[model samples]
Target: MENPWLKINHSDYENHMIEVGQSQILNSLKKYCLDKYQPKNFALLGCATGNGLEHVKSNVTNKVYAIDINQEYLNKTQEKFENQIINLELLKRDIQNEELAIKNIDLFFVGLVLEYVDPKKTLNKIIETIGKNGILFIVIQKNKQTTFVSKTKYKSLETLSDISNDVNENEIDSFICLKNMELIKKEEIELTKSKSFITLEYRKKE
Candidate 1:
């Protein structure tokens, strides 16, 4: 199966997210995790064009890993943050297929990525990389409309509709609990009249 994300440019993705009023909200949510967790080692899964990376403080976060399947996205992130962030690593690998080499990461952020991949397989890989007591911040979209991809001027984003799937909160909770991770908090942010983002924060048991 072809990955639609690779075909879409960062500009188109960002524009679509902005059109749906998700760019600012996503950035704020990522900032919230950074402030609350205060992690020394931070990892962002499916980091698209590094939208929320501006909030990372180099003094607090010594190492930052930005992983994405698209090499173009990784390249853009490197061009933007390579000088600003200390010890920044950009990985071009699919979370569903490749083994994540990151270990002992204090915080892992998975935003709007599970819908495109196998949740169980990806979660297993995530658990392997998170350190003891590591924090996991996951954001999934809940749609009131039948279409998973919201209408936007950027037609390139329409390709994602083929792979995107709606994820249930209860199913995610059950999977994480079985892995010995406990939910710290959960919040739902309404993006538009027909769309909302559900964020789940979990901590690995020591």
Candidate 2:
């Protein structure tokens, strides 16, 4: 079956997220990571249409890898950042099925991506690509009272509900520990009374 993400229109997805007040939150989280870490090399998984990539500065983050499963999203991201961001590399890849060729990323952002893919496989693959002592920022949505797909004017976003799975924070913490990564911090940002985003910061051990 084709991934629902591939079928989602960029505008619809963007509008839906914006309406739900998630895009801005995501942008803020990215900004926080970039400002605090100031990583020379950065990568964003599930980088749809470069939502938070504006935080990337050529002087601070020299290299950027923006990856997404949708080609159209990648095209839009390239159009927006190709001239602005130096060494911006855009890749269209299915993290679940394809082998990631990237390595040595100083900081990696996996925001709301693990829910759509096989969490264990993708997490393992991501760990392999991080440089020693690299930082990893993961954002997982906690939908205790809300549906997996938030209601919006754009119904196209609804297709994602079929593939979206809830990720357990404890499981990831345990898995990363076994993989030689230590948790730097865990923060919970409440989006709504029932919905929140849990941000986990991890660092690869030397």
Candidate 3:
């Protein structure tokens, strides 16, 4: 079966898209965490085409594990960042699958990926994989409900809140509970002609 996350087709077109706005978001995320301890091992979710891979300082990041559901996108990302020599391990795995091997992630970067999966399960897996002192950087989209279409399924920020509400009732008291993780910083940015973006930095409890 084909993966839904691997949606981009043309490499040039994807690169253009990244160059325009995605790169800006990636830069903002990097700047927020650059002062933190240099991450030796980094894991990125929804790493499409590896455009932001180049932004990660080589001296700080020795190994990077890029995960995406689509094999095609993974292949593209691997080929695009092959010369970086950062021990990039491209894995084709579904985030919902609990059997995947992921642990001790110094920095876990998830951008516009969680909306596609079961938010509660995805957060549990992420919290489990990241070390006690590790950090998680997330970028989520916010907008009006009518902006989304059936052909392209994208969850709004309110939808994410709803998912968090369910998790709070069934599992945790709050999605961004300070007991488990503490929010260090947050910034909201607007895109060219779409929804707003919010980047959050969270430090896991020791």
Q: Please, what are the lDDT tens digits per residue for candidate 2 over residues 27-99? A: 9999999999899989999999999899888889889999999999999999998998999999889999997
Instruction: List model 3 lDDT by residue over 70-156, tens digit each.
Output: 788788887888787468898787887744487888889887766566766777777777877888887776554434221222322
After superposition, which runs of candidate 1 have C-alpha atoms over 4 Å from their true positions? none
Winner on TM-score between 2 and 3 is 2
The residue pairs that clash in candidate 1, if any, are: none
TM-score of 2: 0.98
TM-scores for all candidates: the values are 0.98, 0.98, 0.77
Ranking by TM-score: 2, 1, 3
In model 3, what lDDT does residue 200 have?
71
Which lDDT value does model 3 have at 134?
A: 84
Best by lDDT: 2
Stretches of model 3 off by over 4 angstroms after superposition: 6-16, 31-37, 149-173, 192-194
Q: After superposition, how far is residue 156 of candidate 1 from its true place, in Å?
A: 0.6
TM-score of 3: 0.77
